[model samples]
Target: MLWVKAFHIVFVASWFAGLFYLPRIFVNLSMVPPESVAERARLLLMARKLFRFTSVLAAPALALGLWLWLGYGIGRAPGNGWMHAKLAIVVLVLGYHHACGVLLRRFESGVRQRNHLWYRWFNEVPVVLLVAAVVLVVVKPF
Candidate 1:
């Protein structure tokens, strides 16, 4: 169980790295001038690879987290409201990950519906989510 927890922490941190970076790539992608075809292609390739790797990391992270929660009953006891809160944040993180994929698709399809400023703002979302998740887990301030 200790090993599981350690691995879970590692994978979670790795996944969060992707969550933090992919949007920054989007910011760069959005700012790429129309004439910079080579640059756009390069950023798209990086974003695509990062998204795939991040998704792979997310699988182990989620599986290990579920193991800790259900198999080991880490937070199954009564009044463990912090776990529930953390779960909600996890759901939001998943949604955010999906949104990144959608945005990437939009970029791939040559649809520049959003500007760089929007992506700059988007990049901060995972940071806040991570902070909230850490607080819920460590502080358990419910």
Candidate 2:
């Protein structure tokens, strides 16, 4: 159980790192001049690779989170309203993660239409989620 908890923490942190960074790559991608073809290609590659890596980290993080919740009965605990709220936030975070993939696909196919400022704002999503999640877990205010 302790081992599973440790791995969950490590992978969740890893996923958050990717979540925090991948959009910043898109921000740079959005700003790259069309004339700078090579640089744009490189940033695209970086975003794709980071997205893939985050996908990998997210799998185990989610699995362990589920294990902790359902398998370990964390969700069954009384007065765990905070956990439910945290799960709601987790769902939102997952949606944000999925959107990153969609946006990455658009960028890869030369279909992305959003500007850097949009992505700059998008980059803050995980930060807010992270803070909310940590506070929910640590403070567990019900």
Candidate 3:
């Protein structure tokens, strides 16, 4: 149980780290002036590298999380409200994570003319989702 809890903490923290860093990357990318092709390339390269590393972290984080849940959670606490809510939020977070990947690829593909403002607005989604996730985990509001 202790090991499972530890893995939960570690992986959840890593997931949050990725969540935080991704938005900052978008902000940086959005700020790059139109004329600085070289600078844009550098920023894009950095973003790609960061996302790649985060993607690597995400896989293990997700795996360990699932292992912990299946191995420790399901039978241990029957009809757990918070756990159920957290699991649902996890799905939403995963969806957002995949969306970020699509956006990353779009950015990589030189597909300009996207609604930058809309993408910037979309950055808030994860923040709200993360907050809800934390609340579900910590507050356990049943």
Candidate 4:
């Protein structure tokens, strides 16, 4: 179980790395001038690669997380309200991840309607989710 926990932590960290960096890429991409063809291409390549890698990490992280939950019945057990809240946050995180993918596609399609400022704010979404998730899991306030 400790090993599982450790691996889960590793994969989650990797996933968060992607969630963090990809948006920053978007921020840069958002600002790339239309004349800067080379810069746009480079940024697009980076975004595509990071998105794919992060997605791979997400799968194992999610699977291990679920294993921890269902294997020990942590979420199903009583007084596990914290676990429920954490799961809810995780779902939102997944939704955010999906949104990032969609945004990447839109960017690839040359849709830069949203400015760098928008992506700068958008990038904070996962950070908040991470902080909230850590607090819920550690404090178990509920």
Each model's number of backbone clashes? Answer: 0, 0, 0, 0
Candidate with best TM-score: 1
After superposing candidate 4 on the true structure, give the runs of residues whose Cα lies further than 4 Å from its correct spot. none
TM-score of 3: 0.83
What are the models' TM-scores? 0.99, 0.96, 0.83, 0.97
lDDT of each: 0.97, 0.94, 0.75, 0.94
Score candidate 2 by TM-score against the native.
0.96
- RMSD of candidate 1 to the truth, in angstroms, is 0.5
Question: How would you encode candidate 4's per-residue C-alpha lDDT over 1-142 as one tens digit per residue?
Answer: 8888899989999999999999999999999889999999999999999999999999999999989888956567788799988999999999999999999999999987798999999999999999999999788898
For residue 99, what is the lDDT in candidate 1? 99
Misplaced by over 4 Å in model 3 are 74-76, 113-117
Give the per-residue lDDT digits (tens) of candidate 1, residues 76-124.
Answer: 8998999999999999999999999999999999999989899999999
Question: Which residue pairs clash in candidate 1?
Answer: none
lDDT of 3 by residue, 1-142 (tens): 7776687677777776776677567666666678989887987887788777777877877787778778766424755688888788888888888877787777777766445577677778878887897787777787
Predicted structure 1, TM vs. truth: 0.99
What is the clash tally of candidate 2?
A: 0
